[model samples]
Target chain A: MIKLQNIEKVYRTDTIETLALNGINLHVAKGEFLSIMGPSGCGKSTLLNIMGLLDEPSKGELHIDGHTVTRLSDKELAGFRNKRLGFIFQSYHLINDLNVLDNVELPLLYRKVNAKERRRLAAAALEKVGLSNRLQHFPSQLSGGQKQRVAIARAIVGEPEIILADEPTGNLDSAMGNEVMDILIQLNQHDKTTIVMVTHDEQMARKTHRLVRLFDGSQVQ
Target chain B: MLKNYFKIAIAVLKRRKFFTFISLFGISFTLATLLVLTAFLDRIVNHEYPDAKRKQSLYISGIEERGERARSNSGLSISYIKRYVLPMKLPGAIAFSSRSNGTNTYFHGKKIGIDYKFVNSVFWDILEFDFLEGKPFTVQQEKNLEKVAVISQDLRDNYFGKDVPAVGQYLEANNEKYRVTGVVRNVPASTYMLSSDMYIPYTLTKDDMNTPSYFGEYAAILLAKKTSDIPAIKKEYEDIVRRVPHTQKRFLKTTSLADSYLDAYIRGGSQESKQKVWVYTALGIFISLIVFLPIVNLVNINVTRIMERSSEIGVRKAFGATRKALVYQFIVENIILTLIGGLVGLVLAQLVMIILNNADLIKNLHLSLNFTVLFIGLLTCLVFGFLSGVYPAWRMSRFPIVKALKA
Candidate 1:
């Protein structure tokens, strides 16, 4: 669950000022699957980033799982993120140096899980995503869909309450995009995992339980 | 946790082999220079005054006033010794002096040039020379002496056959025959005062002492009963010299033997001569600084490399890695790199020392590992590693997850 009230994010250069998010108020309940749709410069990703605790709000009240995180220190925020939230990026951002198994095990490593348990949990996550056979394959060797699957497995390996998928299908072909979307949908349905996906595709947005559209810097129902 | 850091460091180095090689080579070259300089300095400092007992011996010389000018002489006039030194009730007061020169001649049919010093009977008591054959001459033999000599092994081998008895055999010196009484080993090349091929009693040739060339003032070496009483004894000797009625007006003052030796060598030359030691010291320090500069530059490069890993740092931070952990990781990485370079540098230095020693570029040149050098090298590596890593680690850890991720 996440909440944002009157959130404002501004970017300033030496000669100009830009409003990334303005007076935005939104909420997502537990186990809810929400898709945020917006044009290129409409602050959709900015809003998602703020909700994921990755960015600070110029003026806002933010609550995640009943704790107000707007005033938390950087160290505290990082700890909160590591324990409660997971991230799946459009680029799949898996460290190329590591294999699929190690990439998936990275989140648990930060959690200080013993190596044996980390390996077991990472293998199980890979198995759930139908990537058990590709555990040793590096991201460079994997197809786009397989990389995305690996990213999803990494996200779920920590057993976090909320998963933030930023343009999850942006880099994949349509068929691979469908497969990634299906995996996300299955996670939301079977495991009751809450997922907030940001995408520009109308058809993709239509598949989620609810959609929040953004124009300029404001959110709309 | 440390294992993980090492693994990550290895991975980084393996991935960027060229960068690693360049950095390592730069560091290793600098370290090698440092090692060489350190070893050389150690040799210079430790090689001086090999005989600890010699420090207890005082070298007494004379300063003569010829009209308006005062000349300090390292050689002792035998008259001064008989008049002042022998009459003193100072126990352990033994004095010896020598005249040294090189001569070439046939030794057992082989042509050779050997250095020779003609000294007195008291020379054996003052200088601790180890004899390989026969015994040192007695004071009675020197007082009631005839033609007698002591030869070094180098001269014995050259003049007589290797197994031939050199003692009691007559050797030609300045066309005059002198019987050999003793044979001693060759002196080490590193010594300032050299051991000689032939030592003849000063009494046997007392007539030669009357000539300024033969006496030239012999080096009057004095061994005190208690070395700690040297200052007092030197003061007494100076007082006796000042009282010796001189026709020159400048000969009115007293001077210690230490001051006399210093006045002879150190003061007689240009001021630059005194500064020569400081020049060597400065050169040593300058070379060390030259080596230090490249290492500092490499440290800066290491800092920049660490900065480039900000994204990885941010991800690690987001994974719950503390600022301390990040610092530790970077410092450990630097230490590992430097230690590798240090080992390579040590090996390189040893190789260089071996080559130089074999070539005889420097006398007795050898690489030695001592506590001071070892401590300095280790401390230098640790301090540099920490200093180089701190700023980069701080900058990396300060990265905002949102900004870094977006970048």
Candidate 2:
């Protein structure tokens, strides 16, 4: 579950100011799968980033899983992210130097999990995404779809309550995009995991439980 | 966690080949030059041969005689040593020796140069010399003005071929022939007063102290029964100087101080503590410059290297890596880089010392990487790693996650 009430985000320069998110109000209940649809420069990813605690809203209040995260210190925010939330970026932000297993083990590393346990959990997550055979493969060695699956595995590896994915299949072909979408839908349906996804594709948006569209930094529907 | 950091560090280093090469080259070259210099300084300050008893020995190097119209400061005279130092009950033994003087000789149409010193028989008893052949001349031999000499291994090899025995052979210097009584290992030239090509009987020299003068080209050593006895012996000598009447003084007062070997070198014929401080401070500054300049250059290089890893840092932050964890990881990576460079430096230092020893640029100058020098060199490398790694790691740790992700 996630909550943002009247959240505002602004980008500033010496000569100009621009609003990335304006007076946004949104919520996703427990076990709900929500997709945000927006055009280019519509602040969809910005909203997802704020919900993920990766960026601070210039003026807003955010509550996630019964805790107000806006007042948490940076250290606490990191700990919260490690324990309560997981993120899957559009670019498949798995560390290139780490193997597929190590990439999935990243959040668990911050939780002080033993290496053996981390490896076991990471392997299980990879199995869920049907990528158990690619545990030793690097990000560069994986195909676009395989990389996105690996990112999804990483997002679910920690068993966080909520997952925030920013255009998880944006760089994949339609076939690979469908493969990734199927994995997300199965996770939401089978594991009762809550997921917030940002996308521009209407077909993918239609598969979610609900869809919110944004225009010029404001929610239109 | 540390193991993971190590794995990532090594991977990142392998990923960027050019940056790693440049960093390693700078670190290894700087450390190699420093290790060599450290070896040279170690040899000068603490030699293991010839002057092995230096820690338990004290030397009265120079004498000063002041009068109304003139003041003369020179090396201790034989008369002054006979009257004041030899009578001291605290010292186990007292010996006198003169400064080295250069002399040349010809053997088999080849000209060979020698630096010789005039030493009393008791000199051999106080200093530990490793003899390869024969024995030192006795006190009776010195008293009888016998024509005998103790030559270094190098001099023996030069005067007589290595195949031939040197003990019973004759060596000619200053148009005088003396039978070779002993052949000892060559003392390194850095051990100022103890290094010479050959040693001859002091009685054979013509510096007769018939006149009661307190100055000549001679020095005296008072070897303590134990290292703990040195202060008492020095105090006794100072007491003698204070009590002795200034008879036949060119001016008014006579004074001299017995000092330890290193202290004497630092004093440079002066009793001023300021001179010692100045020398030590200069040495400190010299070592700092050697270590500091390289660290500054390395810090700049490390900053650039870490900046290129900004995206990795951001990804780590997003994955729950704390600032402390990231900084620690970067520093660990840097330490591994420097430690690898340190190993390479040690090898380089040994090779350079071999080349220098073979070059024979300075007479009897043999430099080796003793344990102390090697330990200090390693410590310097660790310090270099910490100092160079800190600023870049701090900057990277403070990097804004959003901006770094964009990068």
lDDT of 2 by residue, B263-325 (tens): 777766654447678998998999788888888888998998888878788878887888888
TM-score of 1: 0.74
Error of 1 at A58 (Å): 2.8
TM-score list, all predictions = 0.74, 0.91
Residue pairs with backbone atoms closer than 3 Å in model 1 (clashes): B75-B217, B76-B217, B76-B218
Across B1-407, the per-residue lDDT of candidate 1 in tens digits comes to: 56656767777777778778877777677766777777766654453322334556666543443334553334556765676666765637566555456677664576777666656776787677778898777887787867787887768877887757888888886666878888887554434243466777788653455433212435566677887867776677767766766534564433324332323233322222244466657777897676667666766777677766766676666555666667788888887877776777667766876776688654334556666666666666666566656777777677777666655
Candidate 1: stretches off by over 4 Å: B44-49, B52-291, B368-384
lDDT of 2 by residue, A5-86 (tens): 9999999999889999999999999999999998999999889989988889999899998889998887898888888888
Model 2 chain A is weakest, by summed lDDT over 10 consecutive residues, at A85-94
TM-score: model 2 vs. ground truth: 0.91
Sorted into a CAPRI-style docking class, model 2 comes out as: medium
